[model samples]
Every structure is written in C-alpha cells, then in structure tokens.
Target: MLYQSFREYAQGAAKIGIGLGVISILARWVTGITIFASPEALVKYGIFGGIGYALMGAIALMAFGWLGKRVRKEFGDGLTIGDFFQFKLHRVGYWMMIAILLITSIEGLFTQGMAAGVLVNILFGIPISIGMLCFFLFCVVYVGFGGIVLIQRLAFVQVICMFAAAILIPLYFFIAKGVENVYQGIRLYHPYLLVLNNHEGLFFMCTGLFIGFGQVFVDQATWQRLYMLEGKKIVPTFLLSGLIWATVPLAFSSLIMVVIFTGSFNNIYSLLFDLIRKIDTIFLLVLFVLCSFGAVTSAFGAGLHSMISLIAGNVYPLLKPDANERQKMRMGYMLAIAIGVLSIVLTFFFTPTLLELLFFFGIIYAALIVPLLFIVFSKGKVDNFIPLCALIGLVAGYTSRYKLGNLDAVWVSMMVSSLLVIVHWGSKFIKKQLGNH
Candidate 1:
C-alpha cells in the first residue's frame, strides 16, 4: 500500500495478476445499485427485463475486453480514461469529455450512496444522513486515501465474500423452499414473468446495448483495470470478469424471487421488505446483508479512487505542469474527501428511482457510444468535431425528453449521434476520393 510516486498511487506499485484483476472488477461492477436495480428490473419488465439488463452490462464488459486489447497495445502506459481522451482529442474536445466524465462519475457515486443509505436504514434502523456519512467517510479514508494498492487488496477479500453470498444464500433458499413449489407459486401470482415472447422486454434489451457500450467505454474505473493488469491479461481478464458479473444479477433476482413466490407484493419496495423478512436463518441473513453492503463499499471505493486518479494523474498536470509528486498526491487526498462529501449531499437530496437515474444518464451514454467507438478504431488523432456530435445529441435528446419520454429520448440521442458520425466519415471519404482523382 505504500507508494511514493503519484503514478504508483494512482495505479499500483506494479501490475496485478489476472485472478486479482477479475475479482477487483467484480467488486467494481456488482454494486449495491446493481443488487437493488436487478430485482427492480425483474419486477418492472418481467423475467426478461432482468436478464436483458444483466446481458447489457455483460456484453459491454466483454466487448470492452476486445476493444481494450487494441487500446493497451497502442497506449500501454495510460493511467485513466482522461489520459487516453487527452491524447486522442484536442484541448476543447478533451475538456468537453472531461465534463461529461465528471458528471457520469458523480452520478455513479450518487447511485451507490442512495443504495447504501437505503440498505443501512433497512438493516440497522440508521438514518439516511448518518448512514451516508459513515459510508462516504469509510470509502474516502480507506479506498480513497489508500489508492489502488489498498483497493486491490481489499477488493480481493470483498469480492470473495460477495460471490460466497451470491452462491450460498440462493442455494439455501431454493433448497429449503423447494424449486417446484416456488415455480408454481410464481405462475399462480405473477404469471407475466414466465412469458417468453415479451416485445417490451426485447426492445429494452436492444436499446440497453447503447447505454452499456458507452458506460463501459467511458468508465474511468474500468480503464484503471485495463492498465493495471499484465498486458497479455487484458482481454481474458475482462472477458472472464464479464461472465462472472452476469451471474450477480441472476443471483440477486433469485433472492427476490424467494419472497415473490410466497405471495403477491404491493411493489418493488414491499418486495424488498419481504425479501429481508424471508432471510430467516441468522447465517443466511448475515450473508445477504454483508454481500449487499460489500457491493456498495467496493463500488464506491473504486469510483472515488478512480476519480481521484483522474484528477491527480491528468487534471493536475494539465493545470499545473510544475506540480511535484507530493503536491499531486496531496491534491488527490483532498479531492477524494471533497468528492465523497459532494456525493453524500447529492444522494440525500436526489430521490429518483434507479430506473429514472438510468434513463436520465442513458442520453449521455447513448450519445457517446458511437463517437467513442469511432475515436478508438480510427488511426492517429482525429477531429475535435467528432466529440461535438455528443454535445449536439445530448442537447437534442434532453430537449425531446418531455415529449418523447425518457426511454425513447435515449434512442433519439443515439440515433442523432450515429447519423452525425456516419455523415462525418462519409464526407471525409468523399473528400479523400476527390483528392485522389
């Protein structure tokens, strides 16, 4: 955990092994938000809704593996997504992206904070503010100040506990309750969940790809894993991580099912209450609580640490080229505390549902996916105008949001950005052909 250089602090003392990397990523992705949101998705759009949601994230992570191999090959010594974008983009484009990234990063911490707040309140009867204060302080003190070195070490232990809970609790539930009885109960009460040919579910799955692509692509936390591993391990580590992560939602969704099968619930909130009640055995109950809490802790820590890394490794250098390593590290510690406090305040005030948060951010994710893909796949530095497409699409999408609804607005944003990119490339090709003639 000891490190002198800012690089060492932001990344690690050296590269990590595949096993550590995969577990660290699992810790990073399977957040309390993921635990809460998965079950909610199952309730909203039926069984496929939950599966599609998991598929979106899994596909994104797996595809990131394929794309990241190319990224690391060309840009091997990167520290954060900020570094990569700065290298690829002009000053304007880079700053624009930094703004977008900053928003998404905060939004990410917000979700975790909200989930953690609710979790503690339910489990321990703690007030939301007190719970959030403890959550934020812990993350900043340990993961934030300790940096990647401590994060990786702690991630190994946390991920192990998560997988243990994910496996054992569900197995116990199914075994005790009987799978056949559970299935019969579900069919008798919530029959739509059993239906396969759900058109809304299929549409949701398809649109989810755009959000997933941009989310994984622009994620600073995921990018940290890319550079923190052995060069040869990049693809397989991420590929394996995605496969492992996909199982998390399934396990969580099943945990909720244990409650759902007993009788009808009023809504997702009541279902959560019932799920908590259903954890009858003390061992199973402790396992479930720890798993959910660990999910929040790991995700929050990864996010807070990565944001600190971005500021220390990239932003500080951009602003003050003369800053020494000690100064950069100091700034990072301060920034971590600041960011954690900001997340606490925001999470306390913003009371949107997880789905609302997803759709709200979906505009940004959808808009950026295509342009970012083009930027990565292209040779050398490209136009700053490429990044502008995201801005235009974002404005267009938000404007249409009230009229078109949040979900459809996401599609509009993606479509607008995709068309712009096509035109940009098409015009470039035409100009090149004319010059050749």
Candidate 2:
C-alpha cells in the first residue's frame, strides 16, 4: 500500500536500501533529454564525445557519493537539501541559496515538460500544448498526492521501460544491420566521428565534466534521495547508481549511431524520427513511447515534488514556525499543483533547443561547482562572501559569453569563482598572521 500512514507520506516507509536506491536514482537520471542529448553529443563531438558524456555523468554521481557520506555524517536527519543549507549557511547565504535552488528546480521541471510536449507531438501528432497539459496533469495527480512512497514505486516501472528501450533497440539495430556495415558506413560518411584525436570532442568532454558535477551536486532531487537512503547504504547506493547510469547514455548514443551510419540527417530530432521509422515495428514503437514519456514524467514529477519539499520544509517554516504537520502537508500539495501549472506555462514560452537550454545554464552550473564544493568540504562555517562568489561568477560569466563563446564562458565563470575563494581565504589567513605579530 502506498502511503498508508502520515509518517509514510512524510518520510516514506523506511530508509531505502541499496537496490531500490539505485533503481530509483536511475529513474531520475535517465531523463527524456538524456535520450536526445546523448545522441546529439555523439553527432556534435564524435563517438568519444558520447562516451565522454556518459563518463561525466557517472563520475559526478560517484563523486556525490562522497559528498553524501559527509552530509549524512553532519546532518543525519533532514528532509531536504534546504535543511542542510539552513544549517551550513547564515541567514543571507541561506536565502540566496534557496532562491537559486528554487529557480534551478523550476528550470529542471520546465525542461522535462518541454521534452514531454515534444515527444507526444512526435509520437502521436498531438499539439504540443495539449501533450504538455496532459503530461503535467498526470504528474501532479500521482506525485503531488501520492508523495515519496508512490514516487519510488512508480520509479521502478519507469526504469524498466527505459532499460528495455535502451538495450533492445540498439541491440536489434546492430544485429539486423550488421556491425561491419554500420562501421563501414560511418567511416565513409563521418570520418570525424571516428577520429581519436578530435580537439573539439576533447574540449567538450572536459567542460562537460564540470557542468555534470555541478548539476548533480546542487540538484534538490538528488539531495532528497540522499536523505531518503539509510546512512550506511548512501555511498554504495550512489556509486552503484552512477556505474549503472553510465551505460544508459552509452547505449542510447549507440542507438543514434545506428541512425547516423545509415544516412544523413538534418538534426538530432530528425535522426530520432528516422530511427523510429527504420525500427518499423509496433512493439518497439510502443516501447520507445513508454520510455520517452516515462523519462520525462518521472523527471518532472521528481523535481516538482522536491521543490514542494523545499518550500514546505524550509520556506514555510520561516514564515510560520508554529505551523503543524497537517498545515505543512497541505502547503506541499498546493505548491505542487501551482508549480506544475507554472512549469506548463514556462514550457510553452521557452522554445529553445535542448542543447541551447543546457549550455545557457552551463554558466550557472560552472559557477556554482567550486563554491558548493568549498561549502561542503569546509570544516567550519564558511564566510557569507562564499555564497556571493556564485553571483560574481554569474555576472562575469554572462558578460563574457559573447566574446568568449558559451563553453569558454563556463570555464571563465568557474575560474573566477575559484580565484575569488582563494583570494578571500588567503587574505583572511594573512590578516590573522599580522594580528598575531
């Protein structure tokens, strides 16, 4: 039974063990965007680029395992990432972080909402608006009402759909088309894809590592999962999830390769359509639809739920410290619907390509990574200026975007934040020495 009690609704039945943790995390990470983006990375940066994308994600999640262990040790009993931020940061710092986190969570929801619309339009010839409306409505009903227990249960089914598509689709193409023919086709058409010494591919891989790290590190949904796991199981669960997650992008990218090796395509979406047409089997078509929809809905639902938790747990309590559990629960459910509707409206307006959207936010992720890591690893309360470091980085990063290009802007943002932190701390150390003298 899902959420049989109030306690179950609030915290789930019990701390998730390793197996469910891995599967649930997988469901969260194997997003609809990943299905498209993995292939896009392959087309843009070559075969190594695809592999790099997979590696970046795996490493980020594995690294989070280390952070998760530390966070649990520091704050063993917490409901959300906001709880951790409230403990670690001063009032102003905590507010700033909460603001940024809320925005990022909304952006995540919007992205998934957009993907759902796109997938439905492609698969069923429905209007994008109608597709998104139905998608968000379903997510709101299930996740908003059912809570974490229901989410975990649904996650198992979603992951099964994703795994089936990821494995069987690529495997079928390889066997039916013949591996040698595919290889020969690629060699003849896109020689760059095969080149080992691809400079652009290498650059993308390096930058992607930074983006991936920051994305996972600051993600509320991920942090929520970290809190949901048993103390001892945390590290192993994340590490195993990372390892398993790497294969998804790799497999999805290979499936794209099956499309590429056959003929020329205008864009990533076109290639996806071409692949679908080639598959030409109703069973595989149904599988792909389930996989895509599941990925998008699961991701959107996770983000929406986590955002509600942050608002209900952190924000509402600040306004009404004496609020009861029933009040908080009511606030969470109401906020979920509001956020779901907001995501649909935002998705309608924001029509950028997926990569464009990611790179635009890449600046933020790059800027946040160093400051966040410093906060996580610091032994004592960090200076409030540490959080300001993200603002400074964002300003500098965006200012340089036109001149330096998107990827370089990300590099600059990270460098600026890292420099500020070093200089700020170094000056403090010197002042201490001078005062002692």
Number of the top candidate by TM-score?
1
| Cα lDDT listed for each candidate | 0.84, 0.84
CA error at residue 131 for candidate 1, angstroms: 1.9
lDDT for 211 (candidate 2): 86
Enumerate residue pairs that collide in model 2: none
Each prediction's TM-score versus the true structure? 0.96, 0.95
Q: List the lowest-lDDT window of 10 residues for candidate 2.
A: 1-10
- In model 1, which regions exceed 4 Å deviation? none
- Which residue runs does candidate 2 get wrong by more than 4 Å? 1-10, 435-437
Provide the clashing-pair count of each candidate structure. 0, 0
lDDT of 1 by residue, 174-290 (tens): 999999999998999888988899887777778777888888888899999888889888888999989999998988888887898867878676677678888888987887888
Query: How much is the lDDT of residue 304 in candidate 1?
Result: 86
- lDDT for 134 in candidate 1 is 87
